[model samples]
Target chain A: MIRAERVTMKFGRVAAVNGVSFEVAPGESVALWGSNGAGKTTLVRCLLGILRARGRIEVGGCDARRRGKALRSLVGYVPQELAFHDDTRLGSAMSFFAGIRRVPVSRARELLDQVELDGHERKRVRDLSGGMKQRLALAVALLADPPLIVLDEPTSNLDAAGRAAVMKSLVALKQRGKTILFASHRPDEVASLADRVLVLKRGRLIEDTRPSLLWPSEAGVLTLRLFVDAERESDAAGVLRGAGHLVNLNGHGLCVAVPGDRKAEPIEVLHRSDIRVRDFQVLADYQPDWSRS
Target chain B: MSSGAVQTAVPLPRPCSAARNVISFARREVRDAVSSRWFVLCTGAFAVLAVGVSFMSLAGSGSSGFAGFGRTTAGLLNMIMLIVPLMALAAGAGSIAGERERGTLLYLLAQPVSRLELLLGKYLGLGIALTGSLCIGFGLSAGVLAAKAGGADAAAMLMLVAFTCLLAWVMLSVGMVVSVVSRKVAVATGVGLFVWLALVFVSDLGLMAGAIVFKLRVQELFIVAMLNPLQAFKMGVIVQMNASLDVLGPAGMYASQTYGRTLPWMLVGVLLAWGVLSLAAAGVLFQRKKSI
Candidate 1:
């Protein structure tokens, strides 16, 4: 869906993206993984033809340098920063984009419903929480029904639930055969949504592999806190251990380490074991070793 | 769900026509401008100030009867000069910088629309909004004058409205140039206010200084006055009302004598040229911008 050859973007004397080359096939999901200032966003901007670079880029068979408008129309983009006119209601904003993308205004309802924002159409953008705004951006991106979706750190600022909701929506998009090129620093997010991971460091593409192979240690693993009856704490830990999860004892609960996408597996295991759970929460998520290095 | 669900569910959307995109952008800009609290306050303040000034002019003249439209418009000229340019500057200063700050500028640019289309839409939209506001403010003042002050001339009022709208458009073009050059909204607004101050007051003071120090000829003074759109507008209104420039002293008299009956039209043409040239420069500057 995207082919970038030796793409080098420079700001002054410093190169932001240095001779990076990669290609995404149809229906493939690729993640640009890196730390801040590692040039993921810069590279994505170059691919989207927002920024002109040294090398050649072709998105959906259109040259990024030559045909910006045509290339952009083929890709739906969700930016890392969410900004809309605060006074604009959700419905009005949708209708405005619908007109820009040349879609029927009525299509807004279905897109909103798909993003799980059906009834909040009348709410002004200022009234929405951080998560709702992200979803709304996603809906706007889909207005043209573009084949490729480019998201730059789609869920970075979101809370746990917000992140989960965006991830779920993305997963649904993937299942519907949308080719996605997203930039993110979260390892668990990379594991869950990305089929192929492109690791970037100081503007260079250092590695390209599957998400499973990138995590050789517990570095990016998440800690989930499961609260139960005080008497059943030990039982919950034992149930998690038997289910092949690494369990640790914490005050008032048991801590289980799991990848972000599988946080529910331990709970499902406990439910099947007839252990009633009281409450649960994510305790912490660690940055992977690649980022730390 | 099947992998082909999205493709099967929705057909591809058609490419938006350039004209439709520009119109959509303009409609949004107008709606935003008209609904803003700043627009409302400016309109109300202008009306109240105009009416108050008209009443004060009559009272100060020791006349119980209403002043004629020509005199009323002359009284309102300074007020319009001070308020309309400021209002237009404030509105236009936010054109590009405000969108960049809100991050919507880049988002919109990433769509199928070109920068020229967006900029043109914004300029046209803001022009309509400003013109609409000026008409309403002047209409309210005229209505009050006709009813409370006995009567006013419809043709004279219409002439004043047309000239004021032209001045607004010229200042608005300058403000858009400020917006395109400045990176932040605050900076653009500050520069806009500074430009307003320069054109309205500082330029006149500077001209006075030049006249005294250099012993400038009346023709030289008239030429300098023609360069400032604000001065051109003020002179245009005065000449239109009185059909002469006797009150403007030597320079105005020189211009009136030199241009004859075409002086007012020449001033109008100067104002129109300022509006068109400044807007064109802004478009070129905006096109050269490398970042959002």
Candidate 2:
């Protein structure tokens, strides 16, 4: 359980997180929803006591700032970036974390199994794919079996399969009664895992409600701009069109309409046709136009 | 739930003791440093330089065999003074700033470890690693000398090695302070090199300029030398070997007359002060560091 009252953190004249207040009951799964620079990560850092902020923050009833060690002991954190040393072996990392967290290596091994990373202990961190590294981070977080799990955009960088694997593990963790708090901008991710969504905008909490009430799971659409080589633009457009996606050449790139949860599909389709997308950006969000289709 | 009641209700994992956390982190640092390419290169350089100096000293003297520990150590002084500080500075400068660059500092701080424990453990581990390398380098040279030159003054050699280790600690402490304040590893390394240049080269030049321009007295020069850790180390070795500072000219003679048999201990104290003061400052700066 966590309680925050008017928490605010400032960098120079700008407040990264401002006067946000919330609470989570034990065993509850909550999501902090926001766009980039929307204070979600800052708020999470404040809660974790990594950043010093003004206001009262209590994790399991103790002030987080006053009792950081205990707060960390109660919360297992998975950062958005996988920053393990490339030369480090999984087994060595596990053992080192175990030693610091004062847990037996057996507990770390069990965690590895829980995260489905067993039998790859000898593999170096660099050899693991994006998803495997993320999962290993998760296992490291669970080294001491902390009561709460806090994740910062857990699947934001993963491919479809990688996202699915991490999502499956998270769903299982929720079922096992671990209090969950995560920061994400993906509607479907919040819908799938969050019981309550706390929407943040520009350093302030704008909305706090049920995820279903905030966004219908299947109704959202995202417009994306995919940039490819100039010579291959037509080929990329043809491949997307062949996949039944409505595509338009916008001079700069091809604009494709995608369902919110199926955004990875267009990129995957392009990859399958050997059309490499140099870059992509979400242009806008709106409901799909049925008449145009 | 109220704070007291919740704490009583849930059983949390007990955090590692401060000493245990420091030791564990230190052991990992040692392993990392020992396996690093820089450590290997540094050890090899020391060995080669030691052997070269030992052989060169005897050859330069037109002697028949390799020099013993006393002669070899005296000849190797300048090389140790140049190499040890640079290696220690590079190692310490990279420690925290490199972790920050790689984004692992945030992850490390997320665990139940204190900043003091991490910093102290890092210092201890690096100190051990540097000490180990120095011993191996000197040991190899000593082995050759013992076989060819018959017997040697092991005590004199040990003293030099000990002083060199202390010098490494002093520079390492200074480098850690730089690492703590720097935002990037590259910046820390640049600043460390600048400091090394200042201490090793510029300081002596400045002292010479001051002696000429201000007509500094021998006693004043001796005071200044005591303040400069490098000069103090050199002077300490000379006093240990010759039992008098006559070879160091007027300032050395002044120091010998003033401190007498206690000069070596005084110089040792100066090195200790440099290490301790720099380390203490680093600890304070590290504790106050807010950003990862």
Candidate 3:
């Protein structure tokens, strides 16, 4: 549960976040998608009350700037950069955070378990891998079981498998009724996981849409490939085009683009025409407006 | 969903509990500093040096045309004053700058803690750490004295230790201010060293030059002495240890004799003023720093 109204942050002459407004409801998972320097991190810092801003910010129903401490206690923040006191063991690090947050020490073990770093309590922070360090940071943030979690590029440094594990843990957090606001530049992650995507360009919000709404129902596109004898490839392309599909000859096969969820229809069309259907895949369902023009 | 279906619960905000917050923050700082290996090494080294110097001075006094009780105490006090400030500066110069470099300051400030609490806690922590070292060093110096002269110098040693601790407090506070104001550890360390040099060496040289050029009276000379922490510290120790040394006037030379009952309080006031002013400046600076 976090709300920001007309928030603007400026550094010298540059407005890092300009008049941005958004709300994250309890138990909602929202992805903040943007390229580098797109103000996503600035927005998160403003919400956390770590950065001074021009407009109103509230976390868990408390004013962020005025009630920063209480707001801090109600929110968990995982910064993009995993920073820890290198010489301290994981357990001591957790305990220190718990002490600062006024949380019980026993919760540290539970948090370590949640991040799948249970037995790593005694390992020094410097000894951890990039992924393990990120996990430990997450565990420290979760010490107080804050109602809302803000992650700034949480999986940016993780490998493919590590990213998957982090995403899985986030999904688990969502199930447990924790609201999450994650900022990332990776498109695939946003496509697969975000319930609502907020697209930012040059410190401005360009689009806010659901994954399903991103692709129009009647305009959904599919790429279909047909395999046949080298001499018959041209004929196969003609047959598919005659069936009201756009067809083009690709290297050794025919590629067809059919409108309105015609993937099944194209296969049937190939069978009837005696054209062999080799393989089919959807390259992308939604065509971004910037590329269309 | 209808707008009426949306439910929002807002809890009343509470004021920060200053006393509890200060105590907890102070405790955390003390724990962190005391548990570190650097603190242990620095304290051990200070004790050994102070005791070794005291023993050497006592044993070699006769061959070198042995100075009397007053000069001997003055020399020992001079060493304490120098070493104590150095120790305090080393401890406090990196207190905040080191945290910023390590990226832990943000995490600490993100909590419910106020800027005042952070500054005060850090000051208190360094004070306790340095004081512990000073006490051990002072204890070793006292033991050396007892073995050499047998109970004659006990009172003087205790007084010297107390004054040296006060002087260390002033240095620690100034270093904390520099640490908070500077962004990098290197810059803070450089500035702290410069300040120590000015106070200990340059200021006294400046005072002597002024006295020579102006043909100032002995009483007027005492005014310039007040400007230097090292002078105040040394004079405070000398006056306490021996009655014969006329350094403050017929009252011994510095006017410390005339200000008898009030001199200790005055020195204390000066140290407290330094601590308070520097600490307050640091608090204000921290309140404005952008989180990284």
Fnat of candidates, each listed: 0.47, 0.54, 0.22
lDDT of 3 by residue, B180-270 (tens): 8777888888888888888877887887798789987776777667656777676666556545337445324446556776776665666
Question: How well does model 3 score by local distance difference test?
Answer: 0.70
Poorest 10 consecutive residues of model 2 chain A by lDDT? A284-293
| Candidate no. 2 TM-score | 0.85
For residues A1-293, write the lDDT of model 1, one tens digit per residue. Answer: 89999999998889999999999998999999877789998998888887888899998888987887778888888998678899998998999999888888878777887777889989999999888889888888888898899999888778778887888778888988889999986767787888999989899999999977765343456867788888888888888878766666746467776765667888899999999878888857533223322
- In candidate 3 the C-alpha lDDT for residue A169 amounts to 71
- Candidate 3 CAPRI grade: incorrect
TM-score of every prediction relative to native? 0.85, 0.85, 0.79
RMSD in angstroms, all models? 7.3, 7.7, 9.0
Which residue pairs does candidate 3 place in steric collision?
B246-B252, B247-B252, B247-B253, B247-B254, B248-B252, B248-B253, B248-B254, B248-B255, B249-B252, B249-B253
Instruction: Say which prediction, candidate 1 or candidate 3, comes out ahead on lDDT.
Output: 1
Q: What overall lDDT goes with each candidate model?
A: 0.83, 0.82, 0.70
Candidate ranking under TM-score, highest first, comes to 2, 1, 3
Per-residue accuracy of model 2 over A3-57 as CA lDDT, tens digit each: 9999998888899889999999999999997667889888988888877789999
Clash pairs detected, candidate 2: none
